[model samples]
Each structure stands twice: as C-alpha cells, then as structure tokens.
Target chain A: MNGHVYIIGLGPGDQNLLTLEVLSLLPTLTDIVGYGPYVERVEVPNTVRKHGTDNRQELDRAHHALTLAQQGHRVGVVSSGDAGVFAMASAVFEAIDQGDISLKTIQVTVLPGISAMFAAAARLGAPLGHDFCAISLSDNLKPWELILHRLKLAAQADFVIALYNAVSKARPWQLDTAFDLLRKELPTDIPVAFCRAISRKDEHIELTTLKNAKSSMGDMQTLVIIGSRYSRVIQPLSDCNPWFYTPRSITKK
Target chain B: MNGHVYIIGLGPGDQNLLTLEVLSLLPTLTDIVGYGPYVERVEVPNTVRKHGTDNRQELDRAHHALTLAQQGHRVGVVSSGDAGVFAMASAVFEAIDQGDISLKTIQVTVLPGISAMFAAAARLGAPLGHDFCAISLSDNLKPWELILHRLKLAAQADFVIALYNAVSKARPWQLDTAFDLLRKELPTDIPVAFCRAISRKDEHIELTTLKNAKSSMGDMQTLVIIGSRYSRVIQPLSDCNPWFYTPRSITKK
Candidate 1:
C-alpha cells in the first residue's frame, strides 16, 4: 500500500480562487490536516477524517500528517494561501529535517495557490506590480528585532512590501512600531493598503499614507501592502473607485 | 451593450493551475487579448475573437484591450502568471494614468493566479517559506543601478530572493554580474535554484550553491531562487528526491 501525503495551499477564503487541481484532489483525500480554520476550508466526505489543530502548532500538525501517510493513509496537510509562503510546506520540511526516521518512506508534494498578497494586489490594482518582498510581522518563530531589521531594509530597498500576520489581539503594537520604523526609511506620503478578509464575503480595502495609517484598523485577517516610491493612486476616469499600481517601467534620471 | 474588461492571470502553463473563476469565465468571453504565447493558452471557440501581439508592446496591448472594452465587447486581457505581478494589471493602470478619456468608462478587473515564483517554489520544496523578495533582472524599464542597489540591500537583509527574467539571449550577462554582486553580501555556500518551464512539459529544476551557479543554465523561461542563510537542502531518508526549504521558524542570533 502506497501512502503519499500532499501539503497543499488552500488559497485565501474564496471558493472560486481554488485551483482545479486542488478541487480534484480534495475529494480523494483520506485525511485532511491543518490549522482549525484552514482544515474547515476543505470540504470532503464525512468518511474522510479531518484533523484540525490550533494555530502555532504547525510542526506538530506536520508530524501527524506524515504519520498518517506512513500508515498508508492519503493525507493532506493544508495551509492558507500558498503553502510555501510562510505556511505548512516549511513546517513539513522542518519536521523532516528534525530527524523523523519513520517519515523516510513518505512522499510529500506541495501545491501552490493564489497567495493573499497577490489576491489583494489584484483587487487593489497592482500595488506590487514592481519588485516586491513579503515579510510576516509575527515574531513567534523569529525575534522581533529581526523583523524590525528586515522591515527597515525592505523599505530602504524601495521594494513594495507585503506584511503578513501584521497584528493580532496579542500583538497589537507590532504593526504600529513597524510603521514608525518605516517612516525613518521611507516618505510619510507612501501609500499603505490594509486588506482584510480577502476574497471572503466581508472583503474590505482601506488605502492610506504612512502618516495617516492607524494600527487599529487591521485585525488578524488583514494583509498590509506598503507601496514603493513609484507607486501611485490613479484617478478613476469614471465613477469607479480609485485605481492604484506601481508602474513596471521607470526611467530614473 | 455593457462593456467590461477583465485583465486575467493564466497561471504558469498548466491547465490544472487555472482557477475556477477564470476557467468558468473563459467560455463567456467575447474576446481574448494578450501576448502571442499567452493568447495561445486560452482555448475558446472561434466565435470569440483572439488578438495575439508581440512582446514589449504592453502599453499598446493595454490600449487595445481597453478600446475593445469601450466598444461594448466583453474582453479578457490575459497575462502569464498573476496579472498583478510584473504583468498586465499595472500596464492597464498605467494606460488609465497616461490619459485615454474613452477608457474611463471601461471597467477593468484584475484577477489573481498562481505566480511562477510560487509554482516553482512549490515544486522545489518551499525555498520561499520565509521572508522573500522578487526582483526582475531585466533592465528594460528600470535602471541597472536601481536593480543592483535593491539586490545588494535584499542580500544584506537576508531575504530568499526570486529572480524573474533572470537571463535571455538579448541580455545574457546581467545574471552573471548579478551573481558576482550577490557574492559580496551572501556566503559562497548559499543555495540557489534554477527553475525552468515551470508546470510545463519541459519542466526542469537545477540546484547549485552560489559558487557553482552558472548564468548560462537559465533562459527566459527560468526563475532563479536564491536561498537565505537559514535555507537548506534536506537529505532524503529513503530513495525519494532531495527536498529543500527555508525553515519557517528562526531564532535570530
């Protein structure tokens, strides 16, 4: 009996954004494992077992998925957005790296999906059209100072920056401090976008400048995009909302 | 006669990577406009008009799509990978910004897809699992100095870097010079991956350290990934292929 596990990216919340490959793979999964919210996103038959764990338990979740696969069960360890982008793919690899000898026979395949940054960028009219970087602002696995260092350098590099896990109830002040640090490296008028509940029914986007940005505006579900110097807010030719983007071509004087 | 235009992402080259929304929206389109190669990817009936143009004609292509939309045609302007990332979304916005009064009435929608970077990363075991940046090595639009400056900062910041359009026949030496520049900030042992023809029939992935990376190994179809200090090539416990990834959790010294 061959038991192979797939670490999959479930994309954001929209069903329409789900890829045809994942949609096909979901029906055949013997066990679906992931964070509670991410596990709930996969709708399979009741006979197919589902293991939903709390957030921050990625390593343990990965170990469980590999164990199930070793037992000849077709398992899927899922993550929100692309699994490779600050998600379960790395956790699975870390588990393998940590010397799980039983996992030797198990094969893991990762599937990419529409990340929150790109999803938000599309709806916002391409704030990340040029060179860009994505940094998770949560200091859970890494130090806060490292996060601060990367944020400052990314701003100075003039790359459009995407902030993931920017703030939660417990870490309310991180995003605030991030903006303050960004101010020293970038102009106060640089565009900032807070994208929340992306692709879900309650999707909302709020655009502001660094000086006007309020840290309280975002919750756990938000993705914050800080545009580069070349980014602009294009006036709508008609009654449509404002279109914003960083042009691809720039001729520096 | 309601005219609307959707600037859509075609994913890389796999039909399975196509989202449910774009797949469903395909048959309903009255026209499809894109670069010659991207236009060939969308297979609609002959009733729907298809316009395929040459490369480097982004502004001209955007104008044509908007003009068709203004003429009351349901138009879809297709882009390879996500439209919002180094693709057509920004070009469309640039067209609007550059002033085409008739385009004001035409509404444009940008849809997200699986970017080439994510697709290649998924196949290569999550090289972008941590903080990462994407840079286009092409100096067509931006100055070489700006690219070099950003590259230096990104390396110094310890970002896992993804290089898009890393090399081509017309500009072959850029990537070679880029590696020399990267060597200044990154260690010689840092891992670099060359992913070519991602999700296509000719898919190929070559792994090398910065010291061994050759510029001639890639072409226009390749996306080169430069791993950070923490990234590693995981050993296979069994007969399976080697896995590589940057661990999600890092304890900065």
Candidate 2:
C-alpha cells in the first residue's frame, strides 16, 4: 500500500495564494489534518475526512496524520503560512523522530507557501527589501530572556525585523517589553508596522513609530514589522496608502 | 486614461508556485518588464509586450516600467521570488522616489510570492524552524566588510541564516570569505544546506556540515541555509530522504 504525507501551507488566509500544486493535490487526499482555523481555510471535497484540533495541539495532530499515512492513506497536513516557518513541518518531524522505527517508511514532503512576513511586507511596501530577520515574540517555547537577547542583537545588526505572535491574551506584556528592549538600541522614530489579518477580509494595518507602538495594536494574528535604520516611509499623495521601502544599496561612510 | 504598475513575484522557479492573483492578472497587463530570464519565465498572452533587460540594470528597468505606466499602459514588473526580498520592489519604489511628481499618482501594488529561502527550507525538511535572518552574499551593492560583519553577528545571535546570491562569477570569493568569517563564531558541526534551483527541474539539494561546506557548492541560483545550533537531521529507514528540523523550543539549562 502506498502512503504519503503532504505538509502544505495555505498562505496567509487568502485562498488565491494557494499554490497550483496544493490546489491540484487537495482533491486527491483522503484526510486533511491541521488546527481548526487552518483546516477550515482549505476548501476540500466532501469526501475527504477533516480532523481539526486546537492550535496548541500540534504534536497530537501531527501524530494523528502520521498514523493515517502509515495506514496507507494519503494525508494532507495544513498550515496557514509556510509550513517550515514556526509551523507544522517541525512538529511533524519531531513527532516522527519520537515515533516507532516503522513510521520512517512513510514519505513526507513540505510544500512552501507565502509566509505572513512576505504578505505583510508586500501590503506595507518593501520595508523588508534589504537584510531582514523573523523572530516570534511568543515565549511559550523559548524563554523570555532568550527572546529579548535575540531582539537586541537583531536591532544592533540593523535587520528589518518581523515579529510573529506578537501579543496574545495570555502574554500581554511581552510585546511591550520587547519594544522597551529594542528602544535601547534602535531609534524611536523608526517605522513599526502592526499588520493584522493580512490578505484577509477586515484586515487592518497600523503604521506607527517605535515610540508610539503599543501592545494593544496587535493580537496573535498580527505580524509586526520593525524597520531597519535604512527603512523609510514615502508620504501618500492624497488618501492613498504611504509607500515604505528600504533602498537596495546603503552608502558606507 | 488609467495607468497602473503591478510589481509581482513569480515565486521560486515553479510555474505552479505562482499565486492565482498573478495568474489571473497576467492577461490583463499591457506590458511585462523584468530581467530577461524572469520575463521569459512568465507565459504572457501575445497581446502583452515583453520588455526584457539585463539583471544589473534594475534602476533603468524600473524607470522603463514607470514610463510605460505613465503612458497609460498597465505594466507588470516581475521578480523570481517574493518581490520585497532582494528583488525588484525596492528598485521600482526607488525610481518613483526620484521621478516626477506626477509619477506618484500612478497606482502601485506589490503581490507577494514564495521566496527561494522558504522553498529551499521546505525541500530540506525544516532547517529554518526557528529565529532566522536572510543576508545576501554579493558585495555589488554593499561593502564586503559589512557583509562579513552581518554574517558574524547573525552567527553570534544563533540565527538560522539564509545566504542569498551566494556565489557569482564576478564575486566568487565573497561566499568563501563569508564561510571563513562564520567559522569564527558558529560551530563546525552545524548542518548546512546548498539548495539549487528550488522547485524546478534539475533542482539539486546538498546537505553538509559547516566544516565540510565549500564555496563551489553554491552558485547565484543556489539558496544556502546554515542551521542554528538546535538543528538536527533525522535518518531515513533506507532510501527515503533524511528529514532535518529544529525543535520549536529551546531548553534553558
């Protein structure tokens, strides 16, 4: 019996962003597995069995998919953004590592998708045009001190920073603390973007400065971008959105 | 007369990776402007004019696209990966910044696509499953010293580093110099992935240790991923590809 697992990224809440490979393969899958929200995002055929779980249950979901694949069923594991970036790819691999040796025979492939950082950057102009880094602000997996350290180093390196999972109901003060930490090394006037629900209906984009940025501006769905020293905003002509871009070359003094 | 410029990413090599928005909007464009290779990659309708330019002439190409838009032509400016990441989006905006005031009235939007870094990462399991940064290795725009400095800092911060424009004919030594610099801060055993022509026919993936990595392993089309300290490789049962992933959490001993 042939069995395989395809870990796919749906791409930042927009159905149109789904890759042709993913769109073509979705109809062939026997089972679709993911977090409730991400699983619902894919419009699979009625014949496919859907297994949805909470966001925190990635391991369990990954194991379930693996079990199905091992049982000779082609399983589709979905993630909202690119699967390799803080998503199900790692969870699936980790599960496979801990599982029985027989599970290693199941073929697994991770299909890339448009991540939130790129989606947010496109909407807000090319603030990430130059060197950039992405660090998740959530401390659920790593300690807060490590996160703060990475933030400071990133600022010192002058990377256009993309912070994922910036604020959640359980961790309200972390983003504020991160801003405070960044303020020490970065200029207060640098542009900070709080992009919520990017590429989705009712999307909101808040263009603020480091000094004026607040934790209330973001939720778990928000992807926050802090511009590098070279990042700038071009004023709007009238009511049009302001264009933000970092020049490709930086003149060295 | 309505005039607009659409800066779009074709995604990493694969036609299937093109977003539905890009596919649907291609037929509506009056002209397509981009590097010769990228321009040829798009399957435009015969009615749409194709203006292909040399790669190093980004500014001139951007100006040309803007000129066509000003002439009431709907223009599509194309890039290979995500437009915002080391691509044409910045050049178009930079051109607009320096051009006539009337140019600001022309509508502009950037459509995101799957970047090579993400595509390569997905193909190589999940090497970028943590905090990461992408730095271009070419010194054509920035100084070699700055590139070396950023590589050192990125290593110090323990980032999963994605090196773009890794090796080119004019600047082959830059990549070798970068690896030597990284050797000072990063351990010798960290896994490095040289992924070439991601998502396309004749794609090649080479997994090696940092100590064993060579400049010859990469070229301009290659996306090199250097895993963080936490990254590990999962051995396959027999003939299947080995899985590489970094755990989401870091245990603070």
lDDT of 2 by residue, A1-253 (tens): 5489999989998888888888998999999999998888889889999998998898899999999998899999999889999899999998988888877888998999989999999998899999999998888899888898899889988999999889999999999999999888998999999999999997899999998999999888899999988888887564578888888898786
Clashing pairs in 1: none
Candidate 2 Cα deviation (angstroms), residue B109 = 0.7
What is the alpha-carbon lDDT for the whole of candidate 2?
A: 0.90
Name the runs in model 1 displaced over 4 angstroms. Answer: none
User: Model 1, residue B171: displacement in angstroms?
Assistant: 1.3
Q: TM-score of each model's B chain?
A: 0.97, 0.97
Clashes of 2: 0
TM-score per candidate, chains pooled: 0.98, 0.98
Indicate the DockQ of the complex predicted as candidate 2. Answer: 0.81
Q: What would the per-residue lDDT of candidate 2 be over residues B1-253, giving only the tens digit for each residue?
A: 5478999999999899888888999999999999999999999779999999998999999999989988999999999999999999999988888888877878888999999999999888898889999998878888777888788889888999999999898988877788887788888898999999998898999999889898899777899999898888998774777777888888886
Residues A1-253 of candidate 1 have per-residue lDDT tens digits of 5588898989888999999989999989899999998898888889889899999999999888888888889999999889999899999989978855667667888999999999999888989999999999999899999999899889889999999999789989989999999988888898899999899999999999988887888888999999988899976666776777999998979
Worst 10 residues of 1 chain B by lDDT: B99-108
* Weakest 10 consecutive residues of candidate 2 chain B by summed lDDT: B236-245
